[model samples]
Target: MKRLLYIITIAIFTVLIQNSCSKDFLEVESADKLYVDEYYNSESRIFEALVAAYDPLQWFDYAWGQYTHIGLVSDVMADDVYVGGADANDCIYLHRMFNYEALPTSVVSDLWTTFYSGVNRSNIVMQYMDNVQGISDDTKALYLAEAKVLRSFYYTWLWKLWGNIPYYETNLTYPYIADQNTADEVYQGIITTLEDAINNGGLPMKAGSGREGRVSLAMAYMLYAEVVMYQNDDSRLNQALKYMEEIIKSGQYDLVSNFAGLWEESGEWSQESIFEINYFSRNAVRSWSSPTTDGGSVYPKFIGIYNLAGSPDYDGGWGFEPVRADAYALYDDNDQRRDGGILNFAKYAEQTGATYQARYQDQGYFLKKYMARKDGNANHSADADLNYNNNFRVYRYAETLLNAAELIARGASGTGTAQSYLDKVRTRAGLNAISPSVENIIKERRLEFLGEGKRYWDLIRSGYAPTYLIPDGLYRTSTWTTSKKYLPIPQSEIDASAGTLTQNNY
Candidate 1:
């Protein structure tokens, strides 16, 4: 019998069955017979349930390129990295995003749904672990550790996107309601979860071959470090620094020689990656907003050239998100990453058969990071259905180094050590070295983590808010001090919570 756990509410119970020789052994059980106690009694059932916990990570828009879009567009609109085009309704929101006026329903929906779904899945796995039998105690501990780490991940996203959210632990099976928790409460919960995972030695220091995609001790430490950095709690800085130092001293990870190789399809499980989201080409599904019936590919759709013979029809809907003239100008001509990271809009148009008509005449560039395709789809077909199975790199060794440098710069009593950390990243980018000044460290972060969905959080952690540009492009101003830093809780979630949860003040 397949034991199933009902997770809709908070109550937890079990069901039993009786069999007789005269009766059919295959007699079906009542649907209501399914309960948590009955299901969690075996190891295999628990393991399968844990596997289901990982599903929410791949939600379209919220996870992949769309995740990058929210941060990049917001940053680019504020600075000179990119500009809005005629058809760039989304970019318009980006430009004015800091203003409470421009918050879009799509952004709100994506943020809320992605993180809550992640939280719910993690809760389910944690709720029923004791019932899993036959597994060694150590193995069960390890699985629990992974669940805690994953829960921290979801909380991290929630902390960054919503600032304050309702914190729920234990599986809620009855659709009970709860009020919102403060930002500090949310941060503490994330820290607690990560610390428990780390102290328990639940995650392996190094990933085993069969556990390639699983979170490890190194990842847990790194995530803890990130949370501490964001919280900006002075007392936690040393702890954050300690976590980073441990990862570095462990010697399990290294920086890849070539930055481009980091994203190359061939580099999926490279040593430099501490943690990354796995996306297989064979199982690729189109993002929810994609217009095509056939699920589209994320990479080719975002980075492929505009028009090339035998190339897939990328809706050419909007031209590639070009490198902003300002961001482009920030780099020296010799910087390899400038060209390596960005694809010129004009160059892309010539390579792909798709036309590169600018939606907004003034804002003309599209992104070029993941543009290459194994093969182009047929015309008018789903061009996004290309064989680009690039895994999204979430945590990398390079980031660990950067995190250390940032911590050291923020008043860590280090003697000339911070500069070396910052230099390593600059050296990799083929740029001149920078001193340990806070501004320089921030600039290095901005340059190194471009288009990776780190900028918005970086700004918030650094106590900087999104600066808005007027429609006429006359002046740039910062409006992030308002409630804009934390996105509003989704209207749908608010409705679901009824009067139990209060909406964030916009």
Candidate 2:
């Protein structure tokens, strides 16, 4: 029997389960005995299945960590921020990742395990769709499409980080020993899955009223464009452009005028969001051991300034993921994006008359995009201060614009379209528009997405990682290599597979 623990939060559903986990992976959960047949005999059960498919998005062990296994790790691995905390040893996984010495057993390993857990959960829900009774065929098709797209989203992260990996569409049997697929095969599979969902699965261009968190055509298009763009192929670039253009023409999404306002609690689920991982604070109660409950995100609390006195509108935080001086230098002083993206700790101290000790090369700059507040938005009780109800923006309209710009700059049709999209993001940042060039688009994306967990992938996808990241003083030890691009598979997984699974050259 699968021992399931569902933490029902204000907005998102989070389910954690324990099955016969192997020595190598805490990922797979048996679905054979998930629920009795009568449980799926009602329409409510179908909705519950859909929610369960979405539940893994907020797992504390997966995404709500001090440095989220997926989102925040990319920036830390790149040249954007330092792993700032009490000392050098705090959150050793992030430090190791930044320095490029992460062992297979380190905290980063959990990302593989957890993301696969999401994949499996999505698979379970998808496989059981046929068993659902009395749901409309359209409704059933939409739910199935949602599961596939969500699986694609999860798999994209896995393949992006791990290169070639085991791929399975159906739920695995016990003692699972799956063969790994090449990265190319995996990418093609992901694209095919999403394309199928978009073309045939009856998903609306956008979710219906008040259905912002659910999967939509816009989300599918965004993911499709993003994955193909990462491949950097010319023929597919135009296809990606078409999808992004469709998203823009759909009129279902738009960028929030105020960049800073994007992070306010009131502005969550704003028009800018294409797909956002929902987290909640209301009705949530977190504990040290549990760390996350009620689907709240810990990224905000982890990146906030530590041990500082509360100001008029702000609160202190655990103070990990400090912004480096070089990252701060990326912006012009007057760039609203800078002011909105990073907390100027120097000026903050001057204003608040607060002082504190620094650690882990802290330059006093903190992440501002997801900073937590003390205004009763975090939790119903005084506890769980670390669990902030900040929804993680997985895909935004701004990014779609950027993607379209990059595609156009890279030989897609619509000459002025690239510059037009660039100007939109620039105008939002209160900056004058610059002519569109691939270099300019790259630089614009870096500046625009500072702490939003994109700069690193931007570097890699643009083929600039070796050029820009290697010479940076922040990277410890040897030079960066293409082989180092993928993190090593956990050794325990290899041992469990008994040679069925091969490890990446980390």
Candidate 3:
């Protein structure tokens, strides 16, 4: 009887254990709980996280690919460049000195989300780096440095767009509200981050064999130099000039012979490129080309017009952003970039059998810089499949040379050598060089970096954005003030903070 009781007890215990195991198996883990802490313990996992951080930087809806919108929405609108008709108001407001209170939802949302997303990702990487093991100290430092530089880049955008922003160093673990930091404070933070990366050997002096998309020490310096120039602080400019000179003397990069090559499909990862947001044609890769299967490229969806004659022009998508006459007139007749970079609306209209006359009722031409060819389509009929591999050029060798020249000219010596820098850019564009003057340098910068999103900041730094009115009837330039230099803090951010954080003046 005792033996029989022992057998029954064993069976009962086995049944309970099996039942508990089954219950545990059925429980689901929450996705939100999965974070940097859970995955960044190994070198391979850390590398994977690093790649994920880069993903946001390459998205078209973000800064890397949405160059046209960012630039036009800020200040440099092309008279003929139109898509979705969103930029019409943007150009008008930007040129005519419209109030920040009047900005469209698209502009407000895109700028807000892109910058925050980039900052959040960078913060995650930085937060987890200390926990990662099995990676070499050099490799670990490089990854950390890259994150810092990228963070600074994103902050620079915030500082430029919304002058006062609540700075977040790492991901918040508890509910918190912070007020906007002053513009100078934000810039100083960026300077300190880049300088630290440079001193710690965190950035690559030159591109490694497989590290085409990564930022080098020289790129960090170039970005720092740009920030200093924008601030117009003499001491900062001198420091910026010193770094620029170092990059120029390094001999790691050069100007590509053909200017168009900088934007071509094949020209990506070129020697002249200091740092670029990498986009690939692979279906699994989240690139501009993989829109439906992944996310679509903004260049095709936003910039590409329906081809009228060739096999791919069926969709009657309206081009929205157009170039201004003033901008068009700035380019010389022989400027190779003028024809290659700016697209004429009438030509596109003639090809598509659409009404071209009223295309730019106010300004006259649309942008051609990022138009897709018929042969480059991935889906052939769908506008989403335009897979041209045009990498966004963030830092280039030519800009470095120009930075160095500008620094020397602006120094206390006041050597009046600004014209030489302006001439170098002009001579490259197949135009005659100009005399060294601040006006010439400003003009050169406008022409050189047109459509690359530098013009608005250039205007701000030169103290001309507030006063520079567009000739078109769309804008009156007098209304813009120093307050207009920074975008108002988004209402959503303020709402989230529930009045704890101060909002910028609208």
Candidate 4:
């Protein structure tokens, strides 16, 4: 089993999820102690600070009253999954988001703050690096590069979800007012920061086994690709393609031979993985009182089969983000992803005599990418559902190949041909190779990353959302429009901004 995340052992970092709208993480410290004066004087302490920076990554699931799994939330907004729960009111914000009805005072506000928390933590980590002593210059540079990567990653999420958002590298002071920038401004800033971190040249192409969860050169490149591609910054696309080619030529990663095996317990951190937002269950103390603890992921439990009975293959859960039957239908029967990416509960029940209490949006389909398997949370001490050993794979080599293919198809040349890259993924999926046209690349992504939450953003970045995100049956009556592209800023954030922050056109 994997070791517990170091953040879990540090109660000093437990006060991470601050209730303030300022995202006042700079204030997070021991009681009655000025930590800045006392800490970060040593290398060991600086490493702890670095791990603390990775903590908010786990918070998007349950740090606040209205939680959001970035993957599930993004999928719900797409055609692959539904905001499935006991009724229309359960995770009702997701339902609102699905129909393009989310308001300023919405649950997705938690997502905004969660990502900001990461930004704050990363900033704090960088501050620690500057103050730290007895550390090698190389180590300090590495830590700083990782911090920049993390900050840019969080900013990328904010930019995609809320185009107009506060941008800050240094922590905000009391009243915590950050300069609100337009989407293009935020885009430029994120790209600049990420580019510096990458070009500064300390990040590893692949983190060694001992540092599996840490940021790597490949992860930074992927984040770079995401931000530039999303902004449609054509000037940077060639550079982005070069980054993809770098990963491919390095030969440090490749697709796992067995497609379904990629999600199994043993498949984690395989050759295919570039980054994973980690979750742990061994000695987990993440109760409802401390959902932000370094424990298990709430995502698997949130989307697992609800009220499942006698399921030898899966565990029961709150039942949100049910996959669409039509999405499953689009897959070829011989495609391994059809079995690995989605859980056909109807077929399972018919074949094995298992059952579930079908709640809202019960199409008998579930996301298998991070599905809660049987006994997934059995080792946890409290709130079993809140803890499951599931790590969200942020980047995989398969995507590296796909990215190279897509970019090459769009006229960026590299070490490999577009057809070879596309063919590699297809042949691995037990399918024949097709031409590496941009359309084929897009369709392949829709298939390759079905429930992993790529469909929505893929549509958005490709300018396909307006037509591709059409109404789906009685569920999504509203088709996606340009105005609904960005989510509304949280009302609480706006109020705390003292009229400094502007809300999106939700």
Candidate 5:
């Protein structure tokens, strides 16, 4: 009864649903593709369109056979992880990316495709909403709000990494060209879309009950704060801080006591979660032939131990991201995150007699957060690796608290003092409370958000990239420079755009 909604499914459904949802509001009757004009005449159809806007975020390059999580590339590009796989051919691009050596030809094109697919679908929904029937003004407002927020979320990724991307509010036609917008322009566009969504006043402070997977007002706020901070927009610092405070004051979210528990199967959508891209495997149908179909994530399989026989603790995997020993040593022994967040495969193998082949650049460590587990991909035919049930927790309460504390430390006014906000997260993680100085918050975020893919950006925005990202001989031979901020635009996109898409000056 699990249905995975997706972008490629769009060709099969004009509005978006083809057993695409399991139940409740997301459930819709499957049909052959219809024209855009023929669909969206009812409230139900319009809802389908809105859901389509969210579907692309779930896609992770199953079709293309690459780890294309928005966070995946960012994490690989960071300094802490080694691109561990069978060899370079299996993960060369990732190794190159981490080394700041990825060419435009070798770019992870799916990152570009997935988010833009979302952007286009979101725009299509709003365009069709104008003519949709059988929905009240209130419902119309709500759907529009959702569409705009989703659109902004998608664009935020493009703006941050790609920079100077083809930006648009409406789906393009004919030549299918969009204006090449600078990062600054994209920022303006995202802010405008988010502001409009907020003014629509149709979203809830938090998603609850049946709306577990949908975006909420607070999620938008978190994203708004994320965008503002990364951009270092001085004017919006106070506004972003206010949004973080609103989530904190709402009492809808709090840190779960167990830091290690955050990665468990039970932790998928816990109290700490603000937003997550959901994946399901109980009835997974997606396979190599139909990569576009609904199924669980292939990400866990990619990061799992390569060439290892199955053990009581975990299944054998391709082993793509071996944690560096230096990064692993950052956690104090008393910190639950060390024991819980990361797994020392060497230590575990010694203690439990579990065996695994050491992957390339093996540091004897693995990210326990998203590793494959026994029964993790159950119900998928034979190919369980492509259907892990790990949902991507995009935003969490801990991040919200930390965001607030960081802002307060930077002198933004807030509901609570910066120290109190910082302490809540630190104390929860079995550490003594410390001053919320910018330096401490920075280190705290490094430990707290590691491998979740905030580190590279954190280093960049905090002006730590130039200094901290020195040319390490192994993975980072090329020191990070200002020009390397944006990834090179995929050459395929440039070819498709003909003259519209220009390559980034990487």
Candidate 6:
């Protein structure tokens, strides 16, 4: 048990409980009143404000129809999996995203609102940090750094999803018309904020045991590099290379010997993890509550096997994001990632003499990375519907190595560093090391992180969407155009902006 205390008990900080769970693994409670003005006189109260900043990461507004909308669904929009569920109309927004048919509305709006909620909370926390008295400057700096990094993390999602967005560092007032900043402005803002946290904020290079869920200096370094790499600028790639090299040399992280073991409950916060979003079903008593009170991720429930006439190993779920047959075929038979990364229902049925019932767009496969397990440890939720304890590894050491390799291939120094990094990942996977190149790096990541939410963004950011996603059977849409590169600003947001916000050229 990680200190899930932050999720269950932080509600005492003047925020009434209900509404948003963590999207980045931060648990949330409703702020019945703006407590920042009245609550920061004590050190403990300051800590609560910091935790509140983390809340929007896991928000799931049931009334607003925002159900676990960030990480899992974001990946489904990519070319890796079909929008699997009850039917074609089920999660139709996601299906539209999958087919490049989504407009600026509902699902898009919900995601926008959720991330901005985080931005708002983070701003609140930072403002209140200044009013605290009797707390050590060091303590204040660390907490402030964590809040700033989290705010940047939220904006990274916004910038990546919608290129033009309103940017602000402090709380805003009524009529709330924030002029949209250019994508470059948003990127620069994220980079500057993280760099400040890294240089001035008192964050340690690594978090001590029992603190892996919190932001560390290493996570900030990783985020800095990831943001720069996404730009695909040769000079920035060189800058990213330096940050990655610093992390590698520090030896604070490494690849877990067993890749498959990384996803198991036992693997939570393993040595290979840099930043992991914590989730728990423990001490939770509801089968269904407003997301604000739920502590466990809904990922397992969303993608678990549904209606399987098999042994209890296949627990029932809503069966969303069915793995594509082509994706299963992408893995070599000997590769460890194949069996560990996916649930091959056909193969499971063959072995157990059980029936794998089909669902909407059923492709005979499902993501195994976060599926709910039958082991006794899973039912920590009293309601049983809320039972799932898996944590999401936001940044893993293996990704850092791959980033180094990709950067080197793009144009960086340190001879053989790229190949050395690639070899390490491949060698662990039971294969001979191939020479490092952009093509091979992309291929390796596709296999290594399937269903782990890396594939689609990897292709899109690398500018390969046209080639990798446009085929007839690859996605519902047979055509890919440059205009589809960035998602449009949510229609509601544009309307609310009253001309201050401009839509993307979709």
Q: On residues 138-167, what C-alpha lDDT tens digit does candidate 4 reach at each position?
A: 888888899899999999889889999999
Model 2 clash pairs? none
TM-score, model 6 to reference: 0.90
**C-alpha displacement of 371 in model 3, angstroms?**
1.9
Would you list the clashing residue pairs of candidate 4? none
User: What tens digits encode model 6's per-residue C-alpha lDDT throughout 144-248?
Assistant: 899999999999888988878899998788988888899899998998898888888999888887666788988998898878888665666776788788878
* C-alpha lDDT (0 to 100) for residue 345 of candidate 2: 75
Give residue 37's error in model 1 in angstroms: 3.0
| Candidates sorted on TM-score, descending | 4, 5, 6, 2, 1, 3
- Per-residue lDDT, model 5, residue 196, is 87
Residue 331 displacement in candidate 3 (angstroms): 2.0
- Candidate that scores best on lDDT: 4
Worst 10 residues of 5 by lDDT: 1-10
Residues 114-229 of candidate 2 have per-residue lDDT tens digits of 67877986786677677877889898888889989989988998898888889889877877878889999899889899988888889987776567678899889988988888
Where is model 3 more than 4 Å wrong at Cα?
1-38, 60-69, 76-107, 284-296, 310-317, 345-364, 377-388, 412-420, 474-479
Cα lDDT of model 3 by residue, 1-506, tens digit = 00000000100111122356467657565554444355678777666666555655654333432333354455433222222344445334333223333443223445666777778778777888888878899999888888888888888878877777877787665576665688888888888888888788567677677667676888789888878888887877766776766766677777776776566666666767787665443332233444322222455334444333442432322344456666777778899777666755566556655543233333545455545544333432333443344456677776776676667766633333555656666677898866656666766667776666677677778777655633345533235456667666666677787676576664
TM-score of every candidate relative to the true structure: 0.81, 0.89, 0.80, 0.94, 0.92, 0.90
Model 2, runs deviating above 4 Å: 1-39, 60-69, 289-293, 376-378, 381-383, 414-416, 474-477
lDDT of 1 at 300: 42
Candidate-wise lDDT, in order: 0.63, 0.75, 0.60, 0.84, 0.82, 0.76
Please tell me which model should have the higher TM-score, number 5 or number 6: 5
Instruction: Report the C-alpha lDDT of model 1 over 63-101, residue by residue, as the tens digit.
Output: 532433343434553443443434446534444453335
Q: Residue 440 error for model 6, in Å? A: 1.0
Q: Which ten residues in a row have the lowest lDDT in candidate 6?
A: 60-69
